[model samples]
Target: MDYGPVIDFHVHLPYRYKDPIAAADYLVKKLDEANVERAVVIAIEGGVESFKKRVNPKYVRNAVQEILDYVAHSPIRSIRTLIFEPDKGIDEHVQLLIEHRRRTEEVVKAVEKYPGRLYPVGSYNPDYGVDKVIERMRVYRDKLLGVKIYPTLHCISPSSSKLYKLYRFVEGINGLVIVHTGCDPGLWELPKMCRYARPKFVAEAAKKFPDIPFIIAHMGSYSAIMPGIYFREALQAYNVDNVWMDTSAVDPLFVERAVEEVGYDKILFGSDFPYLVGFTIEDSIRDILKLDISSDAKRAILHDNAERLLRMLGRL
Candidate 1:
């Protein structure tokens, strides 16, 4: 099962704790035991707490900084993503983007501290008007490697034309997108907003934005029977060309199906992480490795796909 050069394209670093490094240490141990080579750790604003209405942007920033500091000395490569709630509409949207820009500036000033291991990903609420957000992205295109969207929580369909420009912006910047898929966890604010969990919606986006690299998170909502249906359509529609799926927050059976149907080159390994602290990220990778997919396919899923993606975006 020696999956060399494995990479995790999805993971959330727990920041709400008193010590974020403690959490990173736990993750490093897991990665070592599981033989993971590189892991992308996205910053989470809140851990097991209400993040919708009561989230403090300052708190979110501090928590992320703590996690970054912790990962600085670790063996894992931690890619930092600035997270925000897009449902806040215009004013909050402007404020969040401004803050994100500032945070990115700070990271840039401090890049030498973390070196090549750290990179930034931007995000916005598509429902508010993807065009408006792309306007913001135009300002900081150089600092961002890609953007992340949670269509379900934003109550927006990925197929909206408003997002067309946003997708174009990503392509123009040579960036990728990570999307949340499937049913929302029972969080109060999340479930209310997470209506677009269906993979078909994302598939349509992938179809439309053929040049935009999209990663469907949580294996299309971990529907045992659904990914087969959704991915089949995705493959037929996009030939699995620009679309990708991640192992984050998904069931093992769905991962197997994604590899089988979409081919391993389109699947990125991820762990929702921190939210499920002490979670076996490697266990998920191991599950995918056990699948009957060829070693090359396994290699693609574990490492090659992500490497190509990072290369495409000039992040690697």
Candidate 2:
């Protein structure tokens, strides 16, 4: 498609690349392959420890039941354990620590190595102590453009008080927030959790902190069971001046609707790297190019919008 000047707004470190240096190198290679000029790599820290307050007993029980419910409700062919490995970024205890440490190092190294071609974004769960999240954030403030938060995975609402301080922190630092909208896969796929990922949740935060920019990642994209139920919900965020949406792991059909509803200026291109199926970074770029919108709109989504954000964040 030759869609150049791209800025992938959502991505995460893969578990396979144990070494941060190797991971950074590999990412650059893939970016080059897809001709992506830059990427915002999300540092996803997943483990029982990552659970708010170190896994409350009630949370564990609910998680287990949710998994069971998911299994019982889904078509066997779709979610069979052998094929349904939805824990994309979660790691075991030690691995989580190592991966986080490596992820930070990787982002730093990637930026130094590629020079303005990669941006880092830290992840936060409000359930985790706000101070602890802040402590982790301070280390990356100099290097990070913003924070990516998971309401669906952590089973908390975006409007929860726990996230406000973090929002304030990001605002104080002049950083953006990437709110995961839509359904999560695997054990984390409870309707309750996914419900909070809709753009409505982000609107609450935006209303409270109008200065902080919130990008709705996935635009309330849903899993098969729900099927675009929240996508429309996400589009409603267009009313909130500080809110925007990213097209990561999102369908082209929804992207079209997003342009019509939210306008292309608020849409950002995102690959959600290491995406399932054969969805490569190139494919993600192609999806935008294939949208039934103007070339200027595609350009805005692919590069111009993200460039504006990076400039605002002082990353460019």
Candidate 3:
């Protein structure tokens, strides 16, 4: 029951609030409610805007999802339904990037409001154009703890050449990188895209950016349709140093296995808050607290590891 010095490392700005100030306010309120001391908020453009259009009844989106979530965790939990969306045209991709750029700006603004309590991380994608990526991200060049890249949502390889320049930019800024690794539900579930989220691809990047820490978000174990589907890949990636893994939406069972095998030095605690629907930051925190691992590991995952990384980067 004792989770020492908690730091939720993987939260996103509240989609419900378009305003950065309101989003940060809601974030702090939720953090306080969950008893989390600090949180790292990634400004990734989420699927709420796009997914709502696909919902049969837009108003019932959350209501229906809450029920589906209940079912996903029950006795017959293994059953999952996938929503495979086809290729998005160039225009749509540009729009998504534009929105993402806007969110990055908001995150910079939000972090300015709470320096120590809230850490800022921005997002980038190829469609945003290599030039635009750096331009938009420069808004936080000196302020960011790191950048969060989504391979599945953006449909690019973890080690794509398009991202090399971005990596170099992050390196220049002395910031870390967190890459999306695992299957996301809704429009992002296309098998082609899911394949890109595998952590094996990120190993290539880790090798390329030996000086920069690369945290594989979800540790390649995040699958809304198949929980822990890529856990082996995550375990494999954990072997190399300077490449960390986060337990954002990963099952505790996998975390238990990870600790038993790899130890906890490079693991981080992240709550894919607000985006995971039907789940809360407190629930995400409890996932680690409920782990059977020793208190030392729990402290390391919940706080120490992230604290060390942030302090090492001079973000905390």
Candidate 4:
């Protein structure tokens, strides 16, 4: 019943802030210590402000590229994504960014460089008209494998009117969608302005778009902030299919609740990684392993679910 390779599906590689390799290596060591076989790493910084204020989005590109290179030469399998920040990488005011062609080109090169090891996870601001965003997505549908959304920061609901068409487009597509759910340590000011960042909104989205595969990171935003809200979202996930939760941050209680309400089938392993505090990827997995869920469920959550998801996205 032992899942040979523990796959942490939700991990962040240091893209804009400090040293990416240092962050990657730190997680690598933790993964090695935990005997995790593979880890999926994502980059932060969607725009110029994130680049100018906090971290550089280019670092995101480099992080993915370098992580892929390391995976190619090393024994570990590192899954990487091409980040698309609608505000910075794309047009801030428009639903679709103007530099999509250039962005798509970079994504194609990155994927080609790593072959099966690298994949592009397109990001869109749902606050913009969903139709326009979907139109943009249709252009790269052939090349992209997944989609990412940040409803919280964008101050829009997952089911926002602006994103209805986008949601439909995403549901119709074959790739997976990873949503940002959790308290952002860097954006403390956001809480006052955005309330839809709550997991309930995500849960409702899951209910509305039952077919669109969704991975709610940060245990519905528990480990990071709004501890109570995380539990509610986890509880709500149980009502819908095609919606799963991840151990994106350090929320052991939320993990335990996810096991209880959604069953292990609905949980996927994750670690926010470089953005995390004192904990490492190993710590996150260890917290989940301590749950009372069965070994089969654990195996599925830790690796199998992610493996199947990756294959579905053509990354495998």
Clashes (backbone N, CA, C under 3 Å), per candidate, total: 1, 1, 0, 4
lDDT, candidates in the order shown: 0.57, 0.73, 0.75, 0.57
On lDDT, who's better, 1 or 2? 2
Top lDDT hit? 3
lDDT of candidate 1 over 1-316, digit per residue (tens): 5557577777543343334445455555666676766666543211112234443545445434554453234332111223333233323433432332222233233322333444445555533356666776677687566676665445466766767778888888988777766644222112223446556677788878777887777765543222332434434433556777787766677667666665666778776655444667767777777877778877887788888888877777
Clashing pairs for model 2 are: 52-127
Question: What's the distance in Å from true for residue 31, model 4?
Answer: 5.9
Error of 4 at 244 (Å): 1.1
Top TM-score: which candidate number?
2
Model 2, range 1-316, lDDT digits (tens) per residue? 4556688888765557866667778877888898788888887644344553443435444544655655565664324431233332232323434444433445555566666777777777443567887887787677777787777655567778888888898887898888888876643455644666778988898889888889988888857666676887787876889899888888899999878876888889888887545778888888889888999999999989989988977777
Model 4 has an lDDT value of 0.57
- Colliding pairs, model 1: 152-194
* Pairs that clash in candidate 3: none
Per-model TM-score, in order, reads 0.66, 0.84, 0.82, 0.67
Q: For candidate 3, lDDT tens digit of each residue in 1-316?
A: 6555589889988767778899889989999989889998887754333333432332233323444554344343112222111223223433544554436777889878887898888877444656787888886688888788787666567688888898999998889989888877543433444678888888888988898899989877776556776789888987777889999878789889999999999999999887778999988888788889998898899989999998888775
Root-mean-square deviation of each candidate, in angstroms? 11.5, 4.2, 6.8, 12.1
Lowest summed lDDT across 10 adjacent residues in model 3 is found at 77-86
Question: What's model 2's overall lDDT?
Answer: 0.73
